[model samples]
Target: MITLATSVFGIVLCKGEIIKTSVHGPTGKISYKDEGFGGMPVVFVHSFGGNVSHWDGIKDSLVQNRRVVRIELRGHGDSEFPKDGDYRISSMAKDLATVVNLLGLQRFVLVGHSMGGSVALQYAGENPSRVAGLVLVDSNGDPKKNPEEIRTQIKNVLFSDAYVETTETYWKQLLERSKPEVQERLFEELVRAPKDMVIKITSELLDYDPTLSLKRYVGPKLAIVTPENDDKFSLHRLQLGFPHKVIQNAGHWLQLDQPEAFREILETFLQRY
Candidate 1:
């Protein structure tokens, strides 16, 4: 297990070198780290407003026995935001393809958390043979309820003159349960993100409908969700013919709230598939 320290960000990237790779289609660069040597490669895609660091909690353990790849999508982390500002899930999925191709990956397990789950679902649906299985952590393929209030608030913050303040307030609410360091990291990244680009990507995701696409991926899948935060988009609601595991007493950031538990669950699920 390698530990890469970055002077630029003051963050310890575990398992491998922090590599920057260009992902075509979107015409932007993505930051990723690779670790491990054998077994089926396990690739991780983080959520919206997130980066490769999101997997810091479980990545070390995951990489012990299998090749692991974690990507920092465009507009987040060290990745370059697209000049054209194309951050759609489909676009991100294509970017993932670029990563896999660049790394010469064959069949592998795809794991995604939150918005990343949508990208994983889309990718798996389009490239079924390339994906050995899938794991969706605290994710929703198609939200049953439209979060109009959340949308309006985000739009207001993006367009309002008090953009920075309002955005900070909004982010604070989301990261309330995060560790202090994690919260700080997220705030810093969000502040540095191209707001207009982020808004465009988030707006598109809010309207995204992956209902049919998620169901069509006829491959092994494991859904892990926190019971407390599942009301909006519960694992029980996903009829993708997969086992759904519930982690109780946890919030939206399940991995942060219960890292060891989350890691164990994921490792066990991976072993099963």
Candidate 2:
């Protein structure tokens, strides 16, 4: 049976009786959805400018067997924005820590997509013992990979008066091959996000160094990426030998683009390590 309800606190019960709840983190209220029960819990973090719904396609299948917790970073979705405007990745990871601690998730797998993957990396690296496994989906772990020139170019456009227009264009390019409905949903969410917050987070993401975090978390790790990002110097290629797989013909959002293949790889990883 499935029922949906929203409480005064803004919590919602979605399909499959998933409990959508909120927790007060260091910055503000962080919203998350808790569903299923059993096995090591898998916590999902969405990409920048994205919300909990980004995991809609994959969560249903996993929730049938293991607990699935999808988190909305501060300033995204139903989560309250930080009044102080601290949008750094470290602060974002702290928000994630607050949610997991509230749920009493002692040990579980951490799955992050895009910028969310970076947050998962930061959290897992800091709390190595708490994370049983780490999965980064199309996430970049090395800041150096993003050259200064490229960063400057991106920042110029993001900080310029044409920020919103540029952002929309950028998103459109990424979602070019995606289905019309998928593109529309994501674009709407992106448009609704605060422009300043988006710019700040993107700036922080560009400067984030995942080297120490990657080294700290020695647990089993898997890097699922698309063909365009299967570079020899990528974190998966360099650190997670033989545990990386590139989903063919998929874009940045491979989970949505090639869910079956992505799920198979993830399930295989969970079964093996």
Candidate 3:
């Protein structure tokens, strides 16, 4: 059963540990669920406007044999909003590093979906020794996409006074194959995320080039994207550089759209280590 912790600022669920930490001199707290099982830990990072809940579909299956960690990035879930308004991907990467150091994690696999994938890559680049492998799920690492145009479009919508309507429409299209309950919860979290923070990080993300980060990661890497996501980020292009796979007949949210297939692919990748 889901438990919630409501505050004047917003609602935060009580599913995990509320880790009070700081990154880049800005103090804040992040909510993280650590399935403290043995074996190598697999850290899972969620997409834009997503919390740890995004991994619910595959969490149990993943945690069965190994340790699994899911974190709710600041401004996105139960985590506290940054008072300094620094929500850069690099900041988020530092937050991950803090968590790793706090838990004393030595070597593990890092998996990230969408924007989280970029954060994972950043973390791996910054701290290459801690990460054993990398799994990027429908991430925003493609250097081909025009950032300026994307940033303008995103800013136009996000900065507008009336963005809920646009967000609702976008959410509808995004969560096509998600279950009704999943759709409701995810939509709420996405909308509940701090608008300014989201806008800032995403805007910075547009200018942030992930090629350097990807190139720096020398360990085993896997890139997974859905057929629907192929247009925005090319699977063929990624495959040319690293091991890339596509989840057939799935959308951007492949974990929710095709959980079984997603798990199978993860299982295959995990076997490599």
Query: Which predicted model would earn the best lDDT?
Result: 2
How close is each model in CA RMSD to the real structure?
A: 5.1, 3.1, 5.2
Candidate 2 lDDT trough over 10 residues, lowest sum: 1-10
Q: Cα deviation of 20 in candidate 3 (Å)? A: 12
Compared with the true structure, the alpha-carbon lDDT of candidate 2 equals: 0.84
Task: Pick the winner on lDDT between candidates 2 and 3.
Answer: 2
Clash pairs, model 3 backbone: none
Candidate 1 residue lDDT tens string, 1-273: 444343332233444443333344356666777777778889999987788777888888876778889887777767777777788888888878878887889899999988888888889988988998898887764543657787677666677788778777867776776777767876786677677876787677767777666666878888888664456355436553567788765555678768888888888877854
Ten-residue region with minimum lDDT total, candidate 3: 17-26
Candidate 3 per-residue lDDT over residues 155-263, each given as its tens digit: 6887787677776777777777566766776777777766677678767766777877766778888889876665635522543477778887655678887889898
lDDT of 1 at 225: 84
Compose the digit string of candidate 2's lDDT tens values, residues 1-273. 444434423445665475878877887788899999888899999998888887888888888888999999998888999989999889999999998997899999999998999999999989999999999998875766768999888988897888988988888887777667778777787788778887898788778888888789888888898766677767786555537888886667888888889889988888853
Highest-TM-score candidate: 2
Write down the lDDT that model 3 would get.
Answer: 0.75
For model 3 the local lDDT of residue 123 reads: 95
Which sections of candidate 1 miss by over 4 Å?
Answer: 1-25, 147-157, 239-241
Residue 101 alpha-carbon offset, candidate 3, angstroms: 0.6
**C-alpha lDDT of all candidate models, in order:** 0.75, 0.84, 0.75
